[model samples]
Target: MSKEQVVVARKKKKKVKIFPIVNVILFLVISLIIMVPIWKVIVDSFDAKAGYGMNFLPQTFTLGGYSSILSRVALYRPFLISVVVTIAGTFIGLLLATLGAYVLIQWEMPGRNFFAYMLLFTMIFDGGMIPKYLVMKDLHLLNTLWSVILPLSINVYNLVLMRNFFEGVPESLFEAAEIDGCSPMGTFFKIVLPLSKAALASIGLMYAVQFWNDYTNFKIYINKNELFNFQMKLRNMVMDNDIPDEGGIDPNTIANAAVIVAILPFAIIYPFCQKYFVQGVNVGAVKE
Candidate 1:
């Protein structure tokens, strides 16, 4: 190679190394930014002496916060309600997404495009709050868990993702199932579902997280305190200073503990689903 070209190539390699180093530094900074508040919350949750400030570690560490929250019927009841709603909503959401996506993949189905477009249209627009409220009231679902569960379960984005993943599946396998005298439901259960675990896990995780974290629906539709979910309770505790006075523990500590409890389920669940989540997102975004 010419001397100038060799020197230029060396300079380009040096520039490429700088880019990766910059990216690493950038990501580390971003990670630190996100983790700092989380770390503060964790520290404060255990800090009996926790107050209004940035605390890296607890001055007086205690489980008083968790004990106070967990011991209360008010907190636990809402938590149980959240758990039930999350599980039910996730199941129903996955079922609808899978069934709808499977149907959309059937080339010969009548009005397939129409149905797909209708779902897509929802992604673009929604009936305003008054209309939705009236519909829920008419259905007699207001002030009930179903009011929250049913609305969050119908996610068009998840449906579209599942459809994309289904489209990527080999047509030959479906044809083979048909030739073996398998019904549509049989093929879905035996052939399609077995292969779409990644999509299911990813989409199901999304549904679970959505249902678990939802407060607005519960707040708007459910006036009765008994029907409130964990997120709603957490919102009340954090925003409205509604923490029950117990053990003389700091309300800040209890609030932080409640926050941790609210997020704990998903944090424990995500690591196990991480691989499938990544794979599912990639596959669902791309078509063959």
Candidate 2:
């Protein structure tokens, strides 16, 4: 090769390395941005020595903090409540969303366009918090589990995404099933749902996250302490500032531990769901 060609090739290689280095640095920075706070929370949650706030890292580690929250007085009753709500809500939400999406897209029902528009409209405009509260109150759903699950049974965005997923199933498969002994219900179970598993897995994870993090609905709709969701309880532990000093544990410990607990479960579960999550979320984003 000519000397000029060799120099140009070296320069291009160097340029490529530089771009990759920059990208790596950017990713590291963003990771730290996410990791730093989480590390602080986990550390502070156990840092009985650091007092109110964490500094860099904990000087001491103690299970005392975690133990206190689940101790006799605390026992994390709210966490149990949250767990039930989250499980029920996630399953119910996924079921309704899947069925609603399937019916919306595959069926030749009356006023199909109107129903779709109504759902689409919900995504754009809400009945506002006051009206929603009033409706729930009138329906006698306040302070009940239904208050959390019913109002958001079918997330409009999730429904649309799922509908897109259902539509992506091969029409030929449905036709073939129909030609056999399969009815529409049989076709859905035999053909549509099997192909739509990834979408459902992904949406189920999304609903799980929503259930875990939801507070506004719980706050407005459920007033009972027995019914408090994890986020709501964690909010109280952190924001209330006057936690009345449970047993021997200090205020800092309660706040730190609660916040850490609130965040930890999602961190553990999200990666498992990411495979389908990325696929499900992206499938609806582009036109075929």
Candidate 3:
């Protein structure tokens, strides 16, 4: 080959390398834009310097924000209530979603298509707040945690995603289970459920996050402060701008602390389920 051709190939390789480096730099810049704000909040929560404006880093690392929140005996009850509601709601919701998805994917099930359409219909439309409130009142679920749990137990979108995952499971396995005289329940528990960890993790994480962040239903149905969840309490604190502290701690610090506390569960949970969550999203997107 000529020296000119060899030099041209070298230039092409250098260009290719430069393109990837540029892309990497761009991605890094975008990631920092997103992450810096979050890190700022976390740092400011522990910052002891009394101020209202943003500090790029912790001005003075102290537990004043955390202490202000922890000192309030009132905060614990709401925290506990939120934990219970999130755990119970996520479990029950996952159970119902799994069963519903399994049933929808069954080819022999009569009226499955109609039922699926009905579920989709509910997704597209919902009765207004007044009507839902009236229904809850009639059911005697008002002023109770079940008021929140029952209404959001099974999200139609999550159900459809799970159904798609179930469909992706090989038909041969179901047939083999049937040949062994396994009941539907047995097949689901032993065969389907075990293999559906990716879908379950993704959907369960969705439910957990929803339950954790729920505030509207709690505010509407629950009139009693004692029945309030962490989100409801946090909302009250934010609106009232009253952190129960005699010490002159910065309110911004308290607010930032509350924000971190509110999202901590999700931050901890997502990393563990991230692999499954991504896999579930991709697999569920494929057309059956």
Output the number of the TM-score-best candidate. 1
TM-score of 2: 0.85
* Alpha-carbon deviation at 159 in model 3, angstroms: 0.6
Q: How much RMSD separates candidate 1 from the native structure?
A: 2.1
Q: Give all candidates' CA lDDT scores.
A: 0.89, 0.79, 0.87
Alpha carbon lDDT at 258, candidate 1? 86
Give candidate 3's total backbone clashes: 0
138 Cα displacement, candidate 3 (Å): 1.9
Candidate 2 Cα outliers beyond 4 Å, as residue runs: 1-22, 52-54, 73-75, 107-110, 242-250, 284-288
For model 3 the TM-score comes to 0.88
Q: Which pairs clash inside model 1?
A: none
User: Model 2 over residues 1-288: C-alpha lDDT tens digits?
Assistant: 999999999998887557889999999999999988877777777776647554776676666777666662553787888888889998899888888888887567998889999989988888899998899889998889899987767698888888988877777787889889799888878777887767888888888888878898988888788888767876776686745564555567667786776778988888888887888776554233
Order the candidates by TM-score, highest first.
Answer: 1, 3, 2
CA deviation > 4 Å runs, candidate 1: 1-9, 246-248, 284-288
TM-score of 1: 0.93
By lDDT, highest first, what's the ranking?
1, 3, 2
